[model samples]
Target: MNEGDDDISVDKNEDSAVLASPEVLETSFFINKPSKKKLKKGVFNRTWLNWVEYKSFLKEYNHDSSQAACIVCNQQFSVYYCSKAEIDNHIKTKKHQHHMKSYDVNQQLIT
Candidate 1:
């Protein structure tokens, strides 16, 4: 076949191949959006009755008894519900000195 005919066939094949892929139908400025709800202002909103529900959620996730280590001191702690106050206390502890140092370093970097 002539070069012109060969080029046309190749173009046709490519067009058909692209048409077979469903994703090709979607044309937009693509963004990878988060699937999970992000915590805002360090507040986990729950009513008094919902506290029990939150506890159930923790137990379901097997995190009820799990302890997160203090970022500053590397001290082990079981956290039922995490809060800014708890984090502040942990940050002040001797165990968390390293974490606090890193936090300061990061803050400096950002500034």
Candidate 2:
């Protein structure tokens, strides 16, 4: 029709294109993230040390860390939060019960 209009003719015969989201974007955007674990709180109790043989100080797991360990079970647990409950839970475990029974038997024999 016009000088520039004649050069810009529509190409109706050409194929149409459909848009799709990329695989990388779909995975990253749609995936659910893992939940974070709860952290321990509170300081280790002073009297727990007396419960052991030394009866002087708790076997502090690490410096500046409120932690205690079960010598019978050979395991350490965080006491930074709810110190007594943490210890109680550990004591309630079957493994600790079994080991404590064996320890008592050994001690009686040694004496």
Candidate 3:
């Protein structure tokens, strides 16, 4: 082969060696990706419960303060008293509505 061909082959070999190196391969495969931002705690308004009045509607699940389970649907939600929108949305769900109806029927029967 010519001198130019020898130089090209050397360059290609050097590039192949770098590409096949363990450090480069490991770095490419196991990259340290940025983690998702965690939600801020205790930022909710203390008086958030006043908006929807869910205290009588939802009961605490297993006595855990962070979770509120619907008395009607039995669906649990992560509640911060300030998250009235979340509570309201869940209450509006079809499942919640169905359970509410069933609960009413049972209550009527009991009385």
lDDT of 2 by residue, 25-98 (tens): 78766577666777646777666777764232236676656778777777888877778788878778899889
Off by over 4 Å in 3: 1-56, 80-82
The local lDDT score (0 to 100) that residue 67 gets in candidate 1 is: 42
lDDT pick, better of 2 and 3: 2
Error of 3 at 5 (Å): 90
**TM-scores vs. true structure, each candidate:** 0.26, 0.52, 0.46
| Model 3 steric clash pairs | none
Spell out the clash pairs found in candidate 2.
Answer: 41-80, 41-81, 42-80, 42-81
Query: How do all the candidates rank in terms of lDDT, highest first?
Result: 2, 3, 1
Per-residue CA lDDT of candidate 3, range 1-111, in tens? 766564554564355554466878888775776667876542333454354556535765676666667777767787665455667788888998887778778888999
**Candidate 1 off by > 4 Å:** 1-66, 80-89
Candidate 3, residue 63: the lDDT equals 60
**Evaluation by TM-score, superior candidate among 1 and 3:** 3
Write down the lDDT of every candidate, Cα atoms only.
0.44, 0.71, 0.65
Full ranking by TM-score: 2, 3, 1
Scanning candidate 2 in windows of ten residues, the lowest lDDT window is 52-61
Candidate number that wins on TM-score, 2 or 3: 2
